[model samples]
Target: MIFSNHVLLRESLHAVLSTELDVTSVGGDDGEALTAAHKIRPDVIVVDLDGPGRHGLRTVRLLVAELPECAVVALTGRHTPHALRQALAAGARGFASREQPPAELVDLIRRVGRGERMIHPGTALATLAAMNNPLSARERDVLRLAARGMPSAAIAAELFLSEGTIRNYLSSVVRKLNCRNRLEAARLAEEAGWI
Candidate 1:
């Protein structure tokens, strides 16, 4: 199955893959993909990871949790290490750049369907560089909320922690990133695709 918000990309992949395998194209949010995936129960799901608001990664995670038997292949234009790491962390079994030839993507889908994990060579290099992410999971959570302009108190409420704890997390993040303030830390993390 092919899931992407871009109609052209979705249709193109479907047309190409349907020649040798059954294909289903789903458009919209992660929820839509999950629904169709449950009904179709496809062997593999190709998701566009560059979707707005990181919906593609969310979809990958949801599909992996709900349909562990179905392999997921993430396609993205942004081949950054952080993107690759995020997709893998979200449970994607395969990763490929959108710029890759269609034939390569088709082969990746086939391989993943057979339960083999794969990553494009170019993306693999990025993953190697991504090994150095310094923030803890909790720190990332706090920074992510802060990046959205949430005050420390608001972030604390959302994360069910005290405001002082939220402030401490923010301080740690700033110091770890060597930034002058939380705002700068958030900006740096966002630019590096760390959050």
Candidate 2:
């Protein structure tokens, strides 16, 4: 079963996967899907992570806690490391981008049902690159503020660090990331999923 809030996405997905022998049931909306799953006891449940704010994540957590036998897939449009991390952390066995070819979703669901973790290919790479960067806590805070287009003086004031200390941190961040300029360093940090 696939739980989606969007009527069109739910309807289209239902139409595409209804004939598949592996998919026993498909529905639109979380409440209805959960009800149907309880009634039918399907092997897996695919939920749209893009649903309401923390609702999708909370739903996944609840489902995994309540239905240990059922697997959950997080389907979303955003492939950023933050989103993927949140989904996986919330107990989604699979994460697929809505931008991916529809066929990929079927393959992901099947693979995930068999106990494999599915995520955007680049998501792992970017996440790994981010994890490998090893920025210090202060450096990371400075970089985050810099990425938001904050000036050194403002960062220093906000963080209660000396202006010179903030400048040194920015310089160190640039050197660590091997970027020639502050903007370049910020862009690299953001692209590398550091922020």
Candidate 3:
């Protein structure tokens, strides 16, 4: 199965992968993907992880939790080590860049289906750096929005979190990064490519 918000990419992958494997379903949203995954019970699920709002990572996590037997392969446009680490932490068995050829993705899917875990070589250094990242996913989200110049109230509204909660997260981020303020923490996270 293939999951991506981009219709063209999903259809293209389905077209190519269906030739060699049983492409059970192609989904463009989390609800559809989860439903199809449950019904089809595909052996391998390829998820595009670079989607807006990091919904792909959430889907990967849910799929892993709900369908423990299914192997997940994270397909990302960003080859950053942080991206690879995030996918792996979410329970993906394989990580591949979208820049890779279709055949390579197919091979990765096959390998992951066979229970062999792998990460893209391009993320080797990034992966090492990402290990030192002290922020949690929610902290990253808050810091990312903060980095974008959003005020705490706006960030809270955008994230559907309380203002106090947003402030707490920001404070936690500052403390974790050992920065004097949220702005400095955001700058540091941005420089480190953690947000």
Candidate 4:
């Protein structure tokens, strides 16, 4: 099944896939996709990662949770490393660009339907980079607050800790990230999608 808000894109995919495979299309809306999945029980579902007004991560989460037997492949034009990570975290089994050849799309879907998993190489690198981040969860929380320009006092109040504790967290974050200051550590975490 192909799920997308853009009618023309759905039709285009349907046109291409219909020539060689069975296809069903549902609107990008979450409610409609869930309902169709229940009724149609498609072997594989293709959803647009950048669909209109449809947060692809949430959609993928819902489909994966409600239709665990179905394989989902997110199609997108954005195709950024962070976006791909979001898709994988949401439980999508496959990822493909909208610009991929029709034959490739068909093959990817088929492979995923047969219980294979796929990840873009760039996304794998992003995951590796994320693994290298040495900050603890508390340290990351401090940096996230810092990214919003919060002072130590405010972050302490928000976290229900002392100002000195917040400062300690900030210092830890900076040391772990090997940065000169808290601000630089915060910026690095934010840029890496950690915050």
The most accurate candidate by TM-score is 2
Q: Write model 3 residue lDDT over 98-160, tens digit each, in one string.
A: 887778778888999999997776666676676688999999999999988999999999999
lDDT of 4 by residue, 1-195 (tens): 999988999999999998878999888479899999999999999988777886767888999999999999988875555667778889999988888889888888899999999765455566568766677788888788888899889999999999999988888888878999988887777657677
Overall local distance difference test of candidate 3: 0.86
**Cα-based TM-score, every candidate:** 0.68, 0.72, 0.67, 0.70
Model 2 TM-score is 0.72
Model 2 clash count equals 0
Model 4: ten consecutive residues of lowest lDDT = 119-128
- C-alpha lDDT of residue 185 in model 4: 84
Whichever of 2 and 4 has more TM-score, that candidate is: 2
- Residue 183 error, candidate 3, Å: 8.9
Predicted model with the maximum lDDT: 1
Q: Which residue runs of candidate 4 sit more than 4 Å off their true CA positions?
A: 77-82, 99-101, 134-139, 147-152, 159-193
Local distance difference test, each candidate = 0.89, 0.78, 0.86, 0.84
lDDT of 2 by residue, 1-195 (tens): 777766677677777767563554444445666677778776778787775443677778877877878888888876677777788888888888777666777778788888888886767676776677667888989999988899989999999999999999999998988889888988777766677
lDDT of 1 by residue, 8-123 (tens): 98898889889878899999988899999999999999999876665898899999999999999999998776677788999999998888887888888899999999998787
Pairs clashing within candidate 1: none
TM-score of 4: 0.70
How are the candidates ranked when ordered by lDDT, highest leading?
1, 3, 4, 2
As a TM-score, model 1 comes out at 0.68
